[model samples]
Target: MEYKYKLAKLQYDKEKNEELIKRQRKRAGQVFPKQLEVEFWQQHLEQARHNINQYFWSGVLIYFIITVLMITGDYWIIDRNFFKHDFIHSLLGLVNGAFCLLTLFFFAHYKILRPYYAYAAMAMIFWAIVSMTWLTMTVHTEVFRHQAMMIISMIYIMGFVLTGVKPFHMLLTGLMAAVVAMIMLLTLYIPIDVMVMGRVLVGSTVVGFLISKMLCTRERMIFLVMHQARLSEKINRIHAEELLHLSQHDALTKVSNRRTFDEMLDSYFEQARHDEVPLSLLFIDVDFFKKYNDHYGHQKGDEVISAIAKSIKDSIRHMDFVARYGGEEFVVLLPETDAHGAYAVASNIFKAVERLAIPHSQSLVDSNVTISLGFTVYKGEADIFKSDFLQRADQALYRAKQLGRNQIYYHTLQVEEVL
Candidate 1:
């Protein structure tokens, strides 16, 4: 039942992820259901940060080279008529470029940068617009001013794309840059055609917005598909593990079943026949279990069995194996154990079940529920058959029953001990 519940939950999650992926395949899928959209971004943060590092760090080297070229151009004048070099405007451009590099480096190295990426993107757009606008005003030639404005337009678009923020954030940052640019133009009173400036800004904003939407759609699809594949693999692994457990474990007692015990016994018998190590088997049966069930009810009998199984498990070492051999009977296989070790383990198991103190008035052995244990250890002997070794343990169990129940009997080929 526990395994069933877990398998069901995994299936549901897998279906849900696939559904989300399908929804995203449509045109309007960019806008996800509110809470899920938030979760998506949170999960994508590591990838987002990595994309930022690649773009912004690369921008750092580009900007540094631009700064160097700007400084050199202060002395060299190839076109005096088309380009008027104003030191103030050049200084402003150089500062913006250097500041962009340093800011990206600081965010990349210093702190948790994912949360602040949108803000950093907006800052990149705003500063680039300010410096370029001032430089445009300082230029007297239309060629120089037009070129500077085109660069500013690229900056506005590249800010969001390179940052890899959500489409909503991209639009918001673009609109904010346009609004702030108008404010700067009005206050600075830079002499230029306002109509041309408006056209450039609007065109750049529209182009950037469309590109961001397209890129975001592709990214969202890839993320969903990758995660869905992982979810499917997880579901397969979990289902296989649960099925294997069911095939090998007893349903009622949650211990290894009779089939598992039989397979293990055969393997160990073979090992003992050829190897130097000894193989020990302990046969366990509840005392007066039939009478106990008749008096206390079958439910009570089941509870007793489960409790006794647990107690037996806790009493033995991790290397030992315990299984429900049949109704009200169990078997423990101890590998590499000598006579003394097998005897001690059988003794502990008998005492531990007795300590459970489950009420069993039908049990003639004791007022509370108790158990009988019979164990035998077989040292490697080429002369003896594996069937003979198992028969020895069964014979000990019959001997314990004959002497009266609720006790332990240890028997070997040449010796017998009672405890």
Candidate 2:
């Protein structure tokens, strides 16, 4: 089971990678053909930047201490007359200049936030060490030649530890530095054991590469965790929105439920009143719906209601609002519509239901299922209460049912008849 689960997870990850590649292709339009590679480097750059910003000053302080110690150790322990050499001043100047340059860049990094600074700073230090290696190889004293190799090894370890160079760049810089040191020692004909020197150089380079690889893996894992968290957050937000939508809509009819209707009515009425526009309401009821439900089953009754709701939606304008007010009843709100527009909409809804031709053997009004509609248009103002508007529309609906159903009754100044 565990093996199968692991295989499934691997497949899921592969699919995600493909999707990411497709999206990148579409968005970039051929710029990033190798999406995963580009994405990995981009993420590495960001992570490196973050790591530098967090620990850069501290790392610089440690580097300064280590460099000072190395120079002092060489002068005191390895070569008592180190400063007497003709090239000593140049060697110290080069190393000091590189250190100062890297320190200045660290201060500027806050505003710059560029990855190239890291590369450039490391390059400066790298060359300084190379120059020192040459000076040490050419020194008159033969006994201190191995000391130069030891110092070079210290430089490698210190650069990796204190500079926080990104892993890929670190590996490249370390390998190049090691290779150059070996070549320089050989070219200068320094009296040293070739076997020992090669062992030290190759061993240090291998260790540095391993350490850099580990750091890269750590950064990649961090980036993946952050990316997954962001995706999960987005997914959760989408689910929350869907739940909210489902709560406001009828599961059966797929129309706004009573809760949504009440909320929307308040909002629309307020807007219409502020804008000084007219608002209309249509209160609709299915004719003899209880009898139809009893004759057929409640399941068929549900189908009929859903069909009528759809017909009402099809007949209305986009701006109009429809809601399942209760069983066998629906309400519509038309903003900025006058009594004539409401009447026209009601007549169309009547026709839409009739066109459905759903046989209702138990319906008292007609052989087919039908509806009665009543509507009222109000000149949006503060003078009239919302309940009064609803009551007037309800009275018109009652009048339509009394006038023998399947008809429209509209109330404005007084009761008005609509076919």
Residue 42 local lDDT, model 1: 67
Using lDDT as the measure, the top candidate is: 1
Error of 2 at 49 (Å): 2.7
Instruction: Tell me the lDDT of model 1 at 407.
Output: 85
What are the runs in model 1 whose C-alpha is more than 4 Å off?
14-22, 25-27, 54-84, 87-95, 109-115, 258-281, 287-304, 314-321, 333-348, 355-369, 376-399, 411-419
Error of 1 at 64 (Å): 6.7
Encode model 1's per-residue lDDT on 104-221: one tens digit a residue: 5456545776457556756766667666766665665555566677777877677657656666676776676666776787787777678887777767778888887777778778
Best by TM-score: 1
lDDT of each: 0.77, 0.73
lDDT of 2 by residue, 134-198 (tens): 66556655555756677666666655654556555766776787678778878877666778877
